[model samples]
Target chain A: MVATGTWITQPVAFTSYQVTLGRIALVGLVALGLTAVILMGELDLSVASTLAVAGVVMASIDNLALGIIAALVVGLLIGAANAFLVVVVGINSFIATLGMLFLLRGLAFVISDEEPVRLSNIDAGISFGKPLIGEFTPRILLFIFTFIVMHLFLTRVRVGREFYAVGGNRQAARDAGIPVRRRIFTGFMISGLVAAGSGVINALERTAADPTAGSTVLLSSFAAAIVGGILLNGGRGSVFGTLLGATSLGILQVALTLSVVQVDVQNIIIGSVLFIAVISDPNSIRAVSGSVRSFLRGGSVLSKPSVDPKEATNNG
Target chain B: MTSEASGEATTTSEAAARTADLGDRGGADPDIKRRKLHVLEQMANRGIFFFTAALVLIAALFIDGFASLENITDVFHRAAPIGIVAVGMTFVVISANYLDLSVVAQVATAAVVLIGVSNNSNIPMAIGLALLIALAYGIVNGVAVGVFKANAVIVTLSTTFIGLGLLRWASGGSIYFGPSDGPIRSFGTTEIGPFPLSMIVLVVIAIGLHFLLNRTTFGFLLKSYGSNRNATRLAGVNTALVVVGAFLISALGSTIGGFVLAAFSNTAVSAMSSGFDFEALAAIIVGGTSVFGGKGSVLRTLLGVVFVSVLTNIMVLSGLGFGYQQMAIGALIAAAVSVDALARRAAGK
Candidate 1:
């Protein structure tokens, strides 16, 4: 906020902060779900599609409560379908979800007839965008509440800890009787439910549902989870870290907007940031620091260029 | 204590050997029941071949004008660009490098660059510059994945975004259309004796890649490395070179495909080749290439490309809507991958 204020005097008003915060909360809901799936060593590329489908479903229905229920149901079904393909059919998660991503996006397009649906008349009796306390909106509060609950679920629950074990080593987890398949299935379901919630929130906030709503969310959510220190390989990261990561991204977007960076350039910046974060993972960081320290001490960093043959054998 | 320790070591070694054998046979056994399953798995692995034959027969019998030589030629011509790109994807996946999501972005970038640069410069110069740009992206992807040991998926995806963004920014979000009455346009639009030039180019590239993958030392090293990177490294192969080579091949394929597409369309746009990466990958997977790497043939990818093209042609002839067509493609990919996985599992691999 301070940096943004310093950068642009004309736009540095209280409303800017409120808008930015609201945007963060909206995107953070998707990131929260993504963090769990990543922790369980799976990728859900269909989240954006799911969000679109749910949002469309909500916007199309006449009754607000019924619309919300229908959207959640759609989300659960999609999640189950993804889980069935990946877990039951033995398809790789990446391939299965990639397929689902296209399939659901197509479904959304079909259902909405490629038009944005307006929900201005639904009268849900709740204003998600309205400020609940000072500058904080109901959406932001809901996002914060979700973060705390997910953090507890992951850190304090036994079943949640199994997500880590399964992701870290599936065979070992299976051998340890951890019910690896069930954990994976459940993780995907949770992702679906959260994605649905995100869709509903978006519809409520904007009073509209667009078929393309979730398209940009996928990249941004992945960016947040990765920047939050969540390993793409899974079995690591925390909900709190993800929150912080999402907040940082929100701040970065504000700063960029203040600086009047082009939208396309912002994409390039985000991509570069994602690349940097992945390469600067803990293992790489350690290796780089060690090499630097050794170089400073007059030691050869490239002395043993060859990795041990034994290590190679294990990988194959 | 020593006896117990020796016993534990023997058990662990036995387990390791069992797992290794499982991987080798892809979960198959010589028992009668297992042999039956093996046969089924073989048939499933070649499912695209059978499906394509069936679809062609059905189309020839039922659909109007489907059996015409001209329509057949058109399908092959259209399949050429996708086949070209799939050839490189075949190499990448077989080398265990997995998917390159940036191929579509590379294609779009190449198309735009070719048209934009050719507006002022000669055709050959534009082609060279476009290829050079594609090669640069490939090199960066190679370095990130091979040298830095970054995840292939994420690295390629990031590059995809970067490429798309940079291209859009450079073009100022405007479309580019090159001169229509040039040698490049003729190369794209011309046909010789009922065969499109693009199809001939695809066939030539396919043959060359087939030879390179099946009859060379480099091909052997690539497959060996993909199957077991550690083992190949232990054997003193330059694994990094192989990685770089795979990505370069893929990029080159994308460049060629982009050039042909741009020439055929007579225009270039930032979003021209969007979502094409999935199609190329689907063709590779459908062709019976194991996603785990160390196995695949460019020839098979060609067949897969033909199969997808024919399927889309049929759909269009049937007047299926775009939405339904997308759904079918998605379902086909999921089904193909599932069958592959099931076959592998049934083989005990």
Candidate 2:
């Protein structure tokens, strides 16, 4: 889609292509973290709010290193808080994180006084995003680096593989001696940290931290994850798929922008795209198609589920 | 807060029964820890009432004007729309579908359809058409989640974007204002013996839904399904129908809320009902509706709605900004759910 767009938007230089990649890198960072959290059979709806708070906290600081450190710490704290709410308190993950989302968003507004916090040293902040090679700036490099590391971590590391086990069947995993709570904690914390990283990079790129900084992209991150095949039911999908999803979404976004598509129209398209992705889930496709088959045969539109609920429960 | 009136009947009857049960087991264990745990469990079970009482007393004492009948009625009037929405949410949550995130969009869409079409044509037909559209939205969600077995959260989230986007496109992202001195606007503010019409509508809906939830066969099947879907299915129930019914009820609530909200302001905008989704959920959860499903009551949810309204009203009276108010509500949700979880754990449930 991106290549097709580049072809139409004539004089698409290498730098322009890199700009698209740069955009992908930013969204990819957040999607990557989201994918990990979803993989653990839990969710962190607070990521965008965490990003906003982190960005504001970072921009409010004067020292360069300290500002970045402060932002990362803020992310970790929010992530830890989320972990505590879900793991220790035993509140449902989505609801707990939903509360966190509102709380952090309110915190951001309160601290920033409902205004954007400007970076004290614009020159220092701008340098952080400066291109290191052929328009591949530090931001892009960090995204790539993190992607490679996360890919290896999930695929190769023993503990990383355990995350899937934890998400797939938490009780069974616990019975199998996997540290379920720890894995869930790690998943949320990583998501928080990565979300903060995205926030910091965004702050540097924009040279200010708006209280509403990541609200717009929050849905997009979820879209990217869904498109990438990260199951919401958890314990499935890979980081690489999220990267592909993010990149494609990035290209589509640029294409839409170049074509002058209105924001509402773009939202419709994205919503439709998300719908298609969810509908295409293999399990649901089988169920829906089975119902269709039954309907065609003059049976009820929804045929009785083959497994008797009583028998299923008894077996369990 | 109608809870003051309703809470008395519910808390006393419920508490008396609970304490009677405790008396039956009286002095047997004599374990300090066990006795203390029992008291905490009782508190948790009846916590919403106690919480509301404490908040009301504190607010009445500390916040000037909070004790006034006018201010109290204003809070009830303010809670009516969201209370309606929360009543519908009660079904969805009890069924363990988690949430209907599309309520915000559903409300806006209904409002836009109601006022937009009414201005162009007539009010009665506009009401019918708006309800039809809302039902259609409900059906799509119902089929997707019930028949296809799709994740409820993701399906509703996508529908929210789609519904709102389509609404914005259709309405050109503009606010639809009803005629000045329109009958609908007057209906919104019409008072019957000091009770606003909207509040009266809410009470009627609540009473009807309360009976439906407790007395109807569908309601029984819904609770059974929510408590244990597979078990209900084994009992030869069509779980899909029950799930679809739940979503339809939710959409109906949103439609009525839309009518009340847009009528109150004489304007319909897509963003008018923003944050309603969470607010309704917050009320349900605080009302002691288990997030796990199969355990809730419509009357209890009403109390939850009033509790939230009074809290917000007190915050406004104290001159707190919107940010702080949001934070307080957010914290309340987390704390409420956590307390419920802890109490359940203690009771060995």
Give the top-scoring candidate (TM-score).
2
DockQ (C-alpha based) per candidate is: 0.33, 0.37
For model 2, residues B1-349, the per-residue Cα lDDT tens digits are 5445444334433532443343223212345354456565666557777777677767766687776666756776778889999998788888888889899999998889889999999998998888787778778888888888887777888899989989999899999999888788898768764468998898788767776677566677778888898887666566777788788888888999999888877899999998888889888888777787887777777778877887899889988877777788789888878887777787777
lDDT per residue as tens, model 1, A1-316: 2234234533543347876687678778899988788998788889998999999999899888899999999988888889998899888788789888878887887888888899956455256667789878878888988898888889899998888888788899999999888888888888998999899888887888888888778777887888888877787888877887777777667667767989889889878877777777776566456545645777433223322321221122
In candidate 1, how many Å is residue A223 off?
1.0
Residue pairs with backbone atoms closer than 3 Å in model 2 (clashes):
none
Runs of candidate 1 exceeding 4 Å displacement: A1-15, A120-126, A284-316, B1-40
Query: For candidate 2, what is the lDDT?
Result: 0.80
Give the alpha carbon lDDT tens digit for every residue of A1-316 in model 2: 3235335543433336777788788888999998889998788889989999999999888897899999999999899999999999888898899889888888888888889999998986788778888768988999999999899989999888998898788899999999898888889999999999999999988899998888767777887888888877788989988987887777776667667888888888777767777767777888788766755766532224322321221122
Query: What pairs collide in candidate 1?
Result: A312-B230, B26-B348, B26-B349, B27-B347, B27-B348, B27-B349, B28-B347, B28-B348
All candidates: TM-score of chain A: 0.84, 0.88
Question: What is the DockQ of the complex in model 2?
Answer: 0.37
* Best model number under DockQ: 2
Model 2: CA > 4 A from native:
A1-16, A289-316, B1-40
